[model samples]
Target: MTNPAISICRVLLPALLLSACGANSVVISGSFPTPNIGKLPIDLAVVYDDNLLDFMYTEYSETGQEEYYIQSGQSHIQLFNAVLPAMFDNVTFVDNLEAAADSGADAIFVPNIEEFQLALPAKTRLDVYEVWIKYNMRLLTAEGAYLADWELTSYGKTPTETFLTTESAINDAAVVALRDLASTFALSFARVPEISDWLANR
Candidate 1:
């Protein structure tokens, strides 16, 4: 005699897998607003390390179930590199505040990311992949004091929820996270005066 539950699981599993691999990826788009008036700086440097990633990864891990780890930090760095140019027109790097001050950077946009997530429904038929990023950056002066701390989150959705031979859902999740980071930061910067000043100077 065939077990009904077993039969149901067999049918649902494949269907879920199929649907899971083809979820729609959602993304937000935006840019920073022009400051009405302020002292804008130029030339700033970014210093990031394991401490920042550790904080972010911890938060990102909180949103999902099952044990997982970052296969590579390269993606996160690449994403930041991609978005930084667009965020600051005059951005530059220096060894420290002393160098930055000498270089005449009016301000800084120091950012620390807190979270990047890839999510899916638990025990579901489809692969429903989701990507998320949460981070905080401080805009500081050559004095080593902060002008403001900007907290940002970026999220993405996949086109579908299924995985054939390839893992489209996971890929979408990462891409979405990267794209949204730029968009989210752009919007947040536009809304914050200090950020505008910092970016203008950078």
Candidate 2:
């Protein structure tokens, strides 16, 4: 089916929509399939901060006729659950970074959402909905010593013609970003100097 050709101000659809000219509350259900990579021989602990678990991005157009919201916090956990286990022998989750020091883990990983941006076709004058996610990664030893810290970005876009509604296109774009994040993390983990050293010493 083809996307409906309608003005952003007239695209009032979906349960999370607002009565204003237009509003979109796109709920991104994650889809991070397990990677077909070998696991590292280490037990790991991951920390999910409250912000990451409840991440929501909201914005309004300058004209006050459009608003957008992306709910991705819950999906972030699902993304990690799917990828971390494939990258480590044993994976455990902790509420806080400090708690991991005593959790009998070899290392701790903390992923924080640095920024999330969305661009609708109306805003960018483009034919696609775009999503960009920036993440800050903190790596620590079991004893809470710093191993490494780095930033990574993931991007995704869905053609406007592909989805029948704005929220659907936005949702697909966000999913693509999450998938990119998972794949990039798994492939880049062993290449960081500090992390490689930690793995070597272990």
Candidate 3:
């Protein structure tokens, strides 16, 4: 007689494989409130490279049980747009060095997304989803002189129970990370020694 265990495995294996092969994709959307900080009395020009504007990240779970895709580029732009104006006298977007020089702004701000990392509940054996973002930020004069260059990082996490689907949880975590980024930049921008000096001189 065929063993009952063999029969059960045959019935369940395809279902398990189908579930494992499914992919989770999240298209992120984020917003931020204008920070309650004193506005710097300088016009600012911001530059975003193509890569940062259309950033998409993909990874497979450590156990190979799931795959995740996060599209976060546009949300980052939104976050900066919302927060920067509150911190500066004016804000403008520029396409290149030539545009930045001509923008009539006091300084140029460039932010590049250096890396993105994710942790799934499955991989961590925890009931949460986590996201990490690393950014390279630069402040320059209209004449292309570097005022400040630094690395900024942000992190966010959500309890798995907060969302029913993996996609939603991941998206929420990413949004949190973006908010963190905005808060950190707004609060710390003028505190950077070089930036403080520039503000003082201006």
Candidate 4:
């Protein structure tokens, strides 16, 4: 005779696996408001650390029930390219600082992803996931003189009753964080004292 507990497990295990498998890669997109910086055709070189492109995974819980991967390099690039025009009319991707200076760029922009994480559902709540992102940005003159530095962080929560819903919520949270970073950076860049000084000196 089949045990009742065993029968229930047989009926529920497949559903859990199916829900976990539904998690998929997220594609981020949005338009950012351009700050009111004066229109000067600044030539900027953008550089990204190679490690930023790597994907990292985190287990959902000690139960080993699920795992999720987070990757945001492509999304970051998309956001930067879309909004950078507001500050820099000419933007070039450079392999290194030397290349940036050699390319006749007025300023070099380096952005690094310090931390990217999506926490599993809260143990007590079981219905919310927390997403966090930390980014570091540096601006330098063509000759490598430091102009500005920024450390930005974004955190938010999403509802996640099921693995599929959890996945969707994570994606939504990531998009929100990315947009927040972009907008914040734009506003900060326009207000940076060094930027004003640089423009004045130019």
Q: Candidate 1 lDDT, tens digit per residue, 81-101?
A: 555555555666554556666
Q: Which ranking of candidates, highest lDDT first?
A: 3, 2, 4, 1
Error of 3 at 34 (Å): 1.7
CA shift of 188, model 3, Å: 0.3
- Model 2 clash number: 0
| lDDT of candidate 3 over 114-134, digit per residue (tens) | 999999887789988899999
TM-score between model 4 and native: 0.71
lDDT of 4 at 165: 64
Question: Considering only N, C-alpha and C atoms within 3 Å, which residue pairs clash in candidate 4?
Answer: none
lDDT string, candidate 4, 23-139, tens digits: 454544444455556545688998766765553444455566445555667777777767777767888888888888898988998887888777666554567667788888888
Where is model 1 more than 4 Å wrong at Cα? 1-41, 52-67, 94-103, 123-127, 161-168, 196-202
Q: Which stretches of candidate 2 lie over 4 Å from their true place?
A: 1-22, 64-66
The C-alpha lDDT values of all candidates are 0.57, 0.86, 0.88, 0.72
Candidate 2: give its CA RMSD in angstroms: 8.3
The deviation in Å at residue 158 for candidate 3 is 0.7
Where does the lowest 10-residue lDDT sum fall in candidate 3?
60-69
Which residue window of length 10 is worst by lDDT in model 1?
Answer: 27-36
Model 1, residue 62: distance off in Å is 13
